[model samples]
Target: MSAPSSVPLVVHVIDQLGIGGLEVVLVNLINNTPTDRYRHAIICLRGATDFKNRITVPGVSIHTLGRRPGKDFSVFRRMWSVLRKLRPAIVHSHNLPTIDMCVPAKLAGVRRLVHSEHGWDISEERGSSRKYNMMRKVLSPLVDRYVPVSKDIETWLRTGVGLPASKVLHIYNGVDTDFFHPAEGNLIPLPAPGFDLANRVVFGTVGRMQTVKDQVNLAKAFVELSRLRPDLMERARLAMIGDGDLKAECESVIAAAGLTDKTWLPGARNDVAELLRGLNVYVLPSISEGISISILEAMSCGLPVAATRVGGNPELVLEGETGLLMPSRDPVALAEALATYMDQPELMQKHGAAGRQRIEQSFSVTSMVNGYLGQYDQLLGRQHP
Candidate 1:
């Protein structure tokens, strides 16, 4: 079922609606955005996960094009057909995976085209590849606007991609404070059957277990923390939630360190909010990021954060304020940061409280939805009332 043609449709194109930070933002936007304002739909170039059920809106559908890896020109033709049929007022693509969809969207007559850059440029780590930049420049005319989730990404668009300032804007990803609120924590029986984080200064992270996210390094850091200060390890526990290709590798590292009993690596989970509540400190070890929604959600749940100083992380995490920052891919540095929290419970609580306050002041779901909807309004030639 679809919304009546009387309502404007906004079609979002992405790689897949799997369990990731980018997907979390998309779900939040769709669930919070009022249906009366504009109808929404998703076109997964690959396929979606059960996470799609998290969407609460009506008349929204997730269509998969079964994209073949390496090269699949058919995806554009399929996208073209879908957009022509949907007749969306706006065609919004997410990150590099879906940016090329704008061409099909334009050919299908979508008047408004949006592309949100949820991570660093794919041209390279430094985003200095001339070929990829040229490709992006050639496609710039097709995109009406680019939404970067962090100021860092916005800068990249302006400087690295040579995009005009007028066409680029930064919008911070928001958290559901009401849903991710602090709780007494149920780590004893929540995360697993026999696992218990009771009385332990739990440091946890909730994201895909992949190379980019680099959860293995977090495991190594936890091991390093234990080796450096056995007393802190006795009072600390590590929980790595979510599952991906690197999950087995992380488990292997934990097993090799002989600390499997002290850590909980539960694969994919639906009780993320509850798990976050159980944590005293949240850690993000990604090599790169864009205002991590996990950090925002953890902060909303009154948990201090220890994140890699990369991308929009620095923007959201004020060093010595809401959280601590460390160099990415360095387990030793990450370990030192975690030790500070484990040794000082008072610091964790203070920083956690400050983090929650920050969310209330700047990163509420209302503000994020409004920021995006304002862009949609501008592209549609309407005023933001």
Candidate 2:
């Protein structure tokens, strides 16, 4: 299954290509890799959304299996057929659902099989599912390498899923600092409608409006903060970007709280870098996370963060230095964390500078791309450790 030296083909498998941290990293990896050394393709087990357009690299093939609603066993057969034709030198699957293709990939004669665990859903947030663990055990021998986006996920692989520590590689997700850097004054248009760039101090978070993201909690906290601090309400605003199944519910929470005007709920957006530049404080209230790319982007944009102390958030945000961390799902705690910035606006500037410095020192996109390339070369026997 060894590919020719001219250009090795690598196929990435994922549940879907949509607005997410993992998808953003995948796009960056492909766009940054040299075209002369590697060619790329993608296989979406379910289907790909318009987010597929983000891949600016030319000559990359995209395919979809169109999985059905429940128990889509046929996708494995389809994967086998596709892999037989593509004959990729390496087949890399992402997250839980995409891990099913590893066996089919090995059977189809792929040169190497790699799997990545980015984050988890509510049901199996800790990767402790017995069924999934059994499945991983059955497929473990076939996988050449395991890539976890964060150390938390790597620990789950070793302790919860029974993976050998030697087989797991921890790669921190990186941000494109150059693209997400702070803007000059009020140059970028404010994302929300009512906020004036000159007077308003905007606090924001970007991600899908899902239950795990807890945008409803953010709405509740924003309302409480507005009620408690009437003096700051005139100039304070909350912007919740990115849409999901919970968008309507989150809007309902805001409207019910009688603070619809104080909050802005923009559906899925593409101009995140511009929006991040205009934010005064960044907040991530997710009940669960796995090294959020939005957090890194916000930090890179020179904004202080107030994120829930869950998953790999603590790894990115140093408490009281880059941003404040609080318990998840508690509106009071979230409001208080946001209120700290509203109280002493100077801390935002101080911590924001520290956050930008942190990103420059540790989470540059070049570091992430090189980490993946090193792993690929190691598994391909092109590099000796």
Candidate 3:
């Protein structure tokens, strides 16, 4: 069912437009989606609009409600006003907080409502609260389609959140292979100078240095690995890219472990694809995920990975084939996994090649963009026709 509007507007709602896998995917979605048929706009609830530069599509308006922290209902009034003004053909919200905008959207007479779950944050880590789950179930009728980025989340939606199986559409985040493919010869300079990339086995991970990401754990593991294998110190280095509140904590851990010189924390980077090329191995030290775009980008760049077994990481990282997976929050287990790659450098090439092949076979950006477009078309046809 496709809507008849010449260019139907789609309003995307989220808590913040900051750095994260979810925000990255949204940028990719907007950039790749056909512009002639659809117009897109963003509404940020908490107003972290630092990543707006990522949006390349022209005329895509960004709005911030400036909602105060701690259960702000006044944001809904602002959202309602925005809905009335835009009159979007579709209201698509991401994550948990923005889902409430569906209430105002429905009241504003927007028929097409779509919601996506990008996995839990530190707060609702174990699962959604009883009150939150009940609220979701109550608002379930307002959502025309529910897109969960992984099968794990699809199950959570179906059983835990009480969403019907038919309503949940599982879509894995995709990577732009053209932009993130393997480096030719250090096209991007390393942030940490004096380290020899040709000789050193650079192990790196890119993400916001937040509690849920558990970058401190990666720092600890790297320090332990350094202690366990002093001989490999000349050949191994660690890079923790991206920045957040927990960055100081990561620095403290590295310093305490006597690894301040061994590790490089370069804060947030714009040239991630080039940065991915500079590393021999990629790591995802997240406590939770919904098919991480960073892991996919690393694979696309032909870099072998060492990630936790939590969330959708197992779905992406095949044990011993593409990369090794260890238990979450355990520095010892993480160190052991990193040690395997450090010792068996030959495995790095094999797994790195396999990872790129995997990306080409199933996780290309085209496939992900098409999946979202198909859902949009379905929602439009259902609502307008």
Candidate 4:
């Protein structure tokens, strides 16, 4: 391990460190990274929650902008103040809302600025809209390096946003295999009520209950599956994790479908690895994704995945090998895929084993941390030399 003197002060800027894929990645980076090689800090534009407690590293500072609901100019002023005081070597911003931090970071004399594109939000997914593309173009110069979590994102930056391919680097999100591995023995603990593991084949998914994630579609698919195969009603159950604007809407759908007993909406969960192990199969019915960390965690837990074919999901799940990949927003396809696993027990075991092997070989947390460290070293070397 390199000494603290050799390490640079790296600060991460995010919109809100809430319960989501990006937040999980940020937490993992702070927790798993060696302090000897990287002194880290986090800045949340709209304040942070108990999620900050997840970072176990000592001496890591966290600053929240405390911006209100509307547009706040004070965010920029606060960012500048923090940057000036900390004098970080790199200001790494994630997603679009936080991307604006690069401007203040640049103004504050931060030497290197890195912007990571996790995925497109609902508004950006409505076919490239000229206004958003223009904004990206205007802000493109502020970032020194673009870190896109998927190849699709890199392609978008190059073709859609007209960013240089040379500056864009593709880095897939990783999962902690040790922390999220398959549960020993057979008994797994349930984190919420209404989920009885003794008599049901638990089908679970972890994601924000938002429009982009499309939890409504997952509910529709589950209800359709129950209608088609009444036998599964006796053995199958749905566990929808995470909470968002659409939770009440999703609950209403479940009630209408008469799946109140078969489905459980436990909101956002902190013990993801344990929750993943409690399930027999893992599913991600997202309309869009950028290498979902939940999918990786599930795969690492030795659970077969059934994910929508969008964004970086295809790269993580190898279709029939690791898990099945169905078209996005298609309830029939999603239900059919889920039904296949329900009918075939051996297939689930085979696919789940393959998924675990894939994660161990390619997507380990160590590899991800080292990849970011390599990028930091390369950028710093170029600056100093």
lDDT of 2: 0.88
**Cα lDDT computed for each candidate against the true fold:** 0.87, 0.88, 0.88, 0.86
Model 2: ten consecutive residues of lowest lDDT? 1-10
Query: Which stretches of candidate 1 lie above 4 Å from their native place?
Result: 1-3, 121-123, 126-128, 184-198
lDDT string for model 3 (103-150, tens) is 999989897999999888888884668877788899998899999999
Question: For model 1, what is the alpha-carbon lDDT of residue 120?
Answer: 52
Residues 1-385 of candidate 1 have per-residue lDDT tens digits of: 3347767789999999999889999999999987778789999999998999999988798899999998999999999999888899999999887888888898998998999989853235545567766878899998989999888989888998999999998898999889989766344344643346456777899998877788989999998998898887666778899998889998898899888877888888998987787777899998888888899999999889999999889998999999999999999999999999877889988999999999999999999999999899888987546
- Colliding pairs, model 4: 242-267
CA shift at 278, candidate 2, in angstroms?
Answer: 1.5
Measured on C-alpha atoms, candidate 4 has an lDDT of 0.86
Report how far off residue 2 is in candidate 1 (Å).
15
Inter-residue clash pairs, candidate 1: none
lDDT of 4 by residue, 1-385 (tens): 6777567999999998778889888888888877877789999888888888888998888999897777788889889999999999999999888877788899999999888888988987832778877877899888888988888888888898899988898888888888899978884756555566575678888888889999888888998898888787777888888889888988898899888987878787777778888998999999888879989999999999999999999999998899999999998899998899989988899999999999999998788777787788788873322
Off by over 4 Å in 2: 1-5, 187-191
User: In model 4, where do residues sit more than 4 Å from their true spots?
Assistant: 1-6, 187-199, 382-385
Pick the winner on lDDT between candidates 2 and 4: 2
Cα TM-score per model: 0.95, 0.96, 0.95, 0.94
